[model samples]
Target: MPNTIVELRDVAIYQRESLVLSEINLDINKGEFVYLIGKTGSGKSSFMKTLYGDLPLTQGSGTVTDFDLRALKEKDIPFLRRKLGIVFQDFNLLPDRTINDNLLFVLKATGWKDKEEMDAKIEEVLGRVGMKTKGFKFPHQLSGGEQQRVAIARALLNDPELILADEPTGNLDPQTSVEVMKVLQEINRNGRTILMATHDYALLLKFPSKTLKCDGSKVFEVVQKNV
Candidate 1:
């Protein structure tokens, strides 16, 4: 049996008063690398927000990493988020902090208190993304790709069960995008489940997987060739 990490049934996604997606049913099993693809205003962001508790599931039932989306309280959001890792398009790193400090901040916020254990985890995640030696540099000191690698490392600090990457490579050049993609792929190969939202069709062709496309206020799986 497949270990399901994300499961949504009869789910409706909303942004404010507008309904973005309706009657959605989806499942993402553990150890799978799934892609969410769609044009702008096609409900992809809304869907992801609903999963991460940024938007509430007002009209259906859903669960991400075992937290009930519908019953997820504002206070419980932080706890839910700890079980999942999120990556953003622009590499949301603090300009004032070095890569190690940025990652340390996350660990501290998530209740990791041991100095030696935190240091070991920081090194481990950075090593996973091949950013082990770049931890001393600030975000502005690194290139776009390198900053994103640090972001990925930061996401892994909690050892999340599911990773939600929202347009992770949207700001990179083609070659740089591939370099970042390779890091993500390496993470997935090591048994992490990843759900990435992207509009880059070129990446779809290069690293095809189970893809879900948001269209016309509905989310459905598309065959790899169609993607």
Candidate 2:
């Protein structure tokens, strides 16, 4: 049996009282690279948010990295996030900190107390994303793509069971987008399951995978030809 990393059944996603997606049944298995494609307001972000606990799952049953969505508690959100890595469109790195400090902050916040272990982990993840030499640079010192790569490396610090990437290439130019995509592809190749939400159909053609489309308030799998 395939190990399922994310599963949702009869799920309804919302933002406040507004219903975003409904009757959503989906399964993302271990080592799978899945895409969530939709228009700007078609609930792709909301769907991703629900999985990562940014938005609550109030109308359905769901689980992410073994945490029940509906049953998730306030204190549990942090722990839940620790098991899952999240990459955002905005590259949410702390501008005031260097790349090394940015990653260190996460490790410290998550309870790593050993200095050597934390440094080793930061090195490993930065090397994975090809940012090992640039750790001393601040966010402003790198290009958009480079900054995004650092953000991706930060996401990997926890060795998450699943990665929830929301438009990771949204802020990059065409060429740079492909660069960041290559980094993500490499990470996924190494056995981490990734569920990325994006509207970039061009990327779909360049690097096709199992895709799900959110439309008319519903989510369903779409074959590559249809995507």
In terms of lDDT, which candidate is strongest?
A: 2
Give all candidates' CA lDDT scores: 0.91, 0.93
What are the per-residue Cα lDDT tens digits for candidate 1 across 157-209?
88899999999999999999999989999999999999999998988899989
Question: How does residue 196 of candidate 1 score in lDDT?
Answer: 96
What C-alpha lDDT, on a 0 to 100 scale, does residue 135 get in candidate 2?
96
Residue 187 in model 1: shift from native, Å?
Answer: 0.7
Give lDDT: candidate 1, residue 139.
Answer: 94
**Deviation (Å) of 206 in candidate 1:** 1.0
Q: How far does residue 88 in candidate 1 sit from its true spot (Å)?
A: 0.2
lDDT of 1 at 26: 86
Lowest summed lDDT over 10 consecutive residues: which window, candidate 1?
1-10
List the candidates' TM-scores in order.
0.98, 0.98
